[model samples]
Target chain A: MLGDIKTVAQGTFDRYFKMKELYVILILCILNIAALSRYDVLTLNMGKEFMIDGALAILTVVALITSMAVIFEKSRELREKTAHFIITKPYGRSSYIWGKFIGISFLAIFNMAILTAGALIVFKLTSYENVMANNLATEFIYAALLITAEAIVLTALGLFFSMFLSDTITALMVLVFFILGHSFYILEKMSSESSKIFGWVSDILPNLHNLDLKSAITDNITITQDVLGYGLLYAVLYAVAFVAASSMIFSRKDIS
Target chain B: MYAIETHNLYKTFGWFLSKRKVHALNNLELKVPENVIYGFLGPNGAGKTTTIKILLGLVIPSKGHSKIFGIDTHDPDTRNHVGFLPENPKFYPYLTASDFLDFCGKIIHMDAMERSKRKDELLEKVGLTHAANQKMEGFSRGMLQRMGIAQALISDPDLIILDEPITGLDPMGRADIKRILLELREEGKTIFFSSHILSDVERMCDMVGIINHGQLIEHGSLDELRSDIGVNIHTTGVASNALMEGEKLCDYITLKNGEAIFTLTNKSDKDTVMKFISDNGGSVIRSVKLQEELEAFFLRRIQNDEKAREEEVN
Candidate 1:
């Protein structure tokens, strides 16, 4: 089973790589690197706040693009029935769910890692004296990690909807899930104004606001290890639950 | 052990509330022995694809069960010894032939060295060695079909199931596939395939099953099915009057150029017809006994089923 997952992961990665989507993401990374490095060179005295925001924007765009690419490829596979060649092999549906989730997650992490490293290099080379004074180094890394976790959860949701839904519906559904997950706190507040029971119901939706750490980093709020660990745990739980549901639905779906 | 065994298998599609139920397979009891090419004969909408899908674990059967090499079809491990080519399968267009086969080999847990070796060998066998590096998006229909075969054989599986493998190929393409299938059979692989071309099945199938309207109407060796239709006698150099009338035991008789051609429901009619020819001042230059062809047998069975259904409705 492990071998099957690895095979599917590699296959998915290669397919995406061939589609030139990865190249686009790479180009985006390069642009971010050049822009950040130029900013650092022009204003050596500029504070670390600008650097942290640059890292956040680059990673967030990378995450969104990776999710969209993964979802689009999966939809095409279903539409063309190309997935039959893979699913009918000597592997169960769980392998597919894990493989796709991990495959897309790996792409997301790899992209974020490259851009984050580039951002760090620019910061260290230009703003070495201010890096630790403003805590920009650690905060930049934390922001990248946070976005990667969010991307993992989003990848799982995209795969879940792609299993049985059409391309348009799957895209629309995933987009809605992402928007609601991030802004669920607003619903919670509105519900609390009406009744306590309603507020609890609203909380049933995954509160992705917890995963957003950009504000926390930019505001220089102290993000302890416990806070990061809790955020990671929440993302992992949601990803696991979504992937499990995808496997169950995909296993029973009629490929015809 | 049988290569494939399905006992009282059944499948139905659609829901129950204002639902349209399609009985894809109805009590289909099939047993195909090892190391033989079995032709699954049927027309469109005859449940041929459904049965293959059920056995491949693509669609769950509504009733009963099926097994491959004594292992249940529902189990993923059962596919370890099996290879399948879905009807007109569409592969990942982004993958080249080499990459596609490599992916298939990896899914089967083949070692890297062995996977590379088999990939080269299968691409050559399918006449796609030159196109191994070309992506499938530029492939023609025939090329895709050949690649499908190559992928199915990547694992060198024991049991191979193909649906309509040679439907729309040109003569040369059809012949190439036929040759490949024959070679596979020679290597002692069990092949179960469905085809609209009766001649191909008649030439290659060791055993056959005729299905219609979700039911297995006939199943046995070609000879066994042929024997049920008795014998056909074609005679020449005989007077047409000999087949004209009186004690004519032939069911269907056609005469041309003073020769007689007809079918004998029983062997006893052969001697009687010859004697009549001799008494009519004629002679039998040639007499051959031939059995009914697969096409005829298939049509007869399907027609009977349709007639029965009509009778019940009326």
Candidate 2:
């Protein structure tokens, strides 16, 4: 089963890497981050805050794009029946779901790393003294890690929804989930004032806010070890739950 | 034990909005023995592909069960000894032919050494060696079909199931697939395939099953399914008067250049026809039993099944 998962993961990663459109999007994203980091309007005094904000925002977009790429590819696999080649092999359906999730998550991480690296380079190249005095490198790394957690959750969510829904519907659901995940506090607030259903929804929705450390970076507030550890734990739990649900749904699915 | 077996397998697809159900398979009982080429024959939407999918555990049956090599198909290990090629197979277009096979090998858990060896052997066998490194996106339909076959054999499975394996192939490609299937059978592999090419099935299958309306209309050896319809007797030197007597014994007779041809719908009439021709001083030339072709037999069975269903409905 491990071998099957590895094969599918490697295959999925290779397939996504070979898509010229994906590369084009990635390149555009890197350039966008580069330009945003070196924007002249943000003076050197505010350079760290501005660069980190823009980079994290761009990273979110990259994560969303990577998630959508996964959804679209899985959708095409089912629509074109290419998945038959893999699903009919001597491997469990759970392995397929895990493989896809892992593969696309790796791509998401790669994209995030490249964008983060590009943003950091531009920040250092444009504002050398600011970097030395403030020591924003660690903060940027923390911000990237938080975004990576968010990307992992989104990728798993995308894979889960794509298993049972059409491409358009899956994308819409993932997008809605991402929005709701980040605004879970709104749902929590609504629950206190309005209805218990909102409370239930908030509980079920992943609290992506926990993983949002951009403010921490921009404000130069040190993110405690406890907070970072909890955030990572939350992301892992949410991602695992989504993947487990996906596996259960996919195991009984008719690949016809 | 049968290489493939299904007991009262039933499946139905339901439209969620309309609440209308399409019965794809109804009490489908099939038994395919090991080490033989079994041809599954059916018209479009006759449940051939559905049955194959069920056997591969790609689709779940609404009722009943199927087993491969005596193990339930729902078990993933059941596929350890089986390889399948779907109809109009689609692959990861970005992958080269060689890479695609290697991926397939890994799915079946073949180690790197075994995968490498099998990859080369299958590519050469399928005549795709030249395009080993070329992306499958650039392949023609025939090349893709060959690639499909190669992947199906990458595991060196005990049972190989293919749906419409020869649909997009030229005559030579078809012949090559036929040779491969035959060779696999010789090596103790059971092959179950469905194809619209009845002539190819007729040439390769040791046993066949014809299905329609989600039911098995015919299942048996080719010879058993294609019973001798009648016999034709050719004779020479039969006097015109004797020819008339021979015609009375036979279903019909034709004469040309002092030669007589007798066609009998009944096999028993052949001996009588021959004896009468001998008594009439006519020399027998040859006698040939006329048997139905698989295509004709398949059509006749399906038509009869449809007629029966109509009568039942009426």
Local accuracy by lDDT, each model = 0.80, 0.84
Query: Any runs in candidate 1 off by more than 4 Å, and if so which?
Result: A25-58, A117-133, A187-204, B16-18, B127-140, B226-287, B291-293
In the range A119-191, model 1's lDDT, one tens digit per residue, is: 7776666644565566667866777887888888888888887876776788788778778888886766777
Per-prediction TM-score: 0.82, 0.89
TM-score of 2: 0.89
lDDT by residue for model 2 (B26-133), tens? 999999999999999999999999999999888899999899999998888898888888888678888899888888888877789999999999998888899999
What are the per-residue Cα lDDT tens digits for candidate 1 across B86-198? 77778888878898999888887889999999999999998999999999989988888889889889878899999999998888878888888899999999999999999
lDDT of 2 by residue, A46-86 (tens): 65567678778888888887877778877777667677888
